[model samples]
Target: MSSDQSSNKKKNNFTIIKDDSTDGHGGYGAGTISLENMSSIIVDPNEDKAYVDMAAMHARSDVERRVKWINDREEVQGGKLYWIVWVTVDKNENGPYYAGVAGSEIRVNREIKRAYKSMAEHVKHMEKSLKGHIIVEHMDDHSKKLLGDFLRDYKPELWENSTEELTRQLF
Candidate 1:
């Protein structure tokens, strides 16, 4: 393909999620934009997941609850529901980056990483030095992966060598 096509492809990495309001029952439905100027759809508590929607599973309550209740409903990877909310961030007429999907794990991973970094900094300052080391424990493999995937998925600039591996198993 041409260089422009290649660039577009690279920018298409993020999955866009807009606001969805029809997920009041089974928690899944089509999307309709409420605002005109908005470029994406947003996912709400009572709405279903959809392309262009910025969706969140309440982490502890909503996501776990729904993923279980609708076990394997949209099964993709080994009977597990796989929902990919797509978004188009067109850079051509719009700007430089356009059309993509936003990985929720990415957002979550950043959040945890920020928290971890902050905690680590606080500890080092309080203890007078980070001579020992830094690490995040207590979480399970799944939780770690959830955050790891986000890091590896979106924040590639922040990942490298052992850092990626450490965070993969830790955050």
Candidate 2:
């Protein structure tokens, strides 16, 4: 596509925008064909507590033992099935995607929004308490996008870009 066409394309539809601080390799990070709501938080595996906790839960059930633990308070808050969605991101293309899903609902979209806020605080605590751990909680729609906008809105400088593996999972 010509430069004009490319710019026009971006204007017509939502596209993932990546800051080329690290490198221009964030191909899809440049933008995506899908709608913004369909975007996802491309997490850094190194910081993926979900992947780590699954390994720990097998041997021990302690919260300390688990890489990521659902808040007991939140778990018992909404309903019998309450799950929280957690995501991690890096500043560049190199990342490991980690997300946590809980079946619990806090009720209404507002509650879900608050739930995300609480989760963000929880993740900040996790990052501080756990050494060398990078954790972030961003809200993504069912398609997992503004997890991109969130990243952009929150940190325009830290662009992790998108991963092919993460995109493939969407299909």
TM, every model: 0.23, 0.22
- Per-residue alpha-carbon lDDT of candidate 2 for residues 67-135, written as tens digits (9 for 90 to 100): 333444453344221122223333344442322211112211223322212445534433332222322
Worst 10 residues of 2 by lDDT: 99-108
Best by lDDT: 1
Per-residue lDDT of candidate 1, residues 1-171 (tens digit): 899968845643344334566765645554433221212222221232222222322223223222323122132222322222222223333243312222222111222222111223322322221121223343334444543454344445434322333543445
Clashes of 2: 16
lDDT of each: 0.31, 0.30
Best by TM-score: 1
The parts of candidate 1 lying over 4 Å away from their true place are 1-134, 161-171
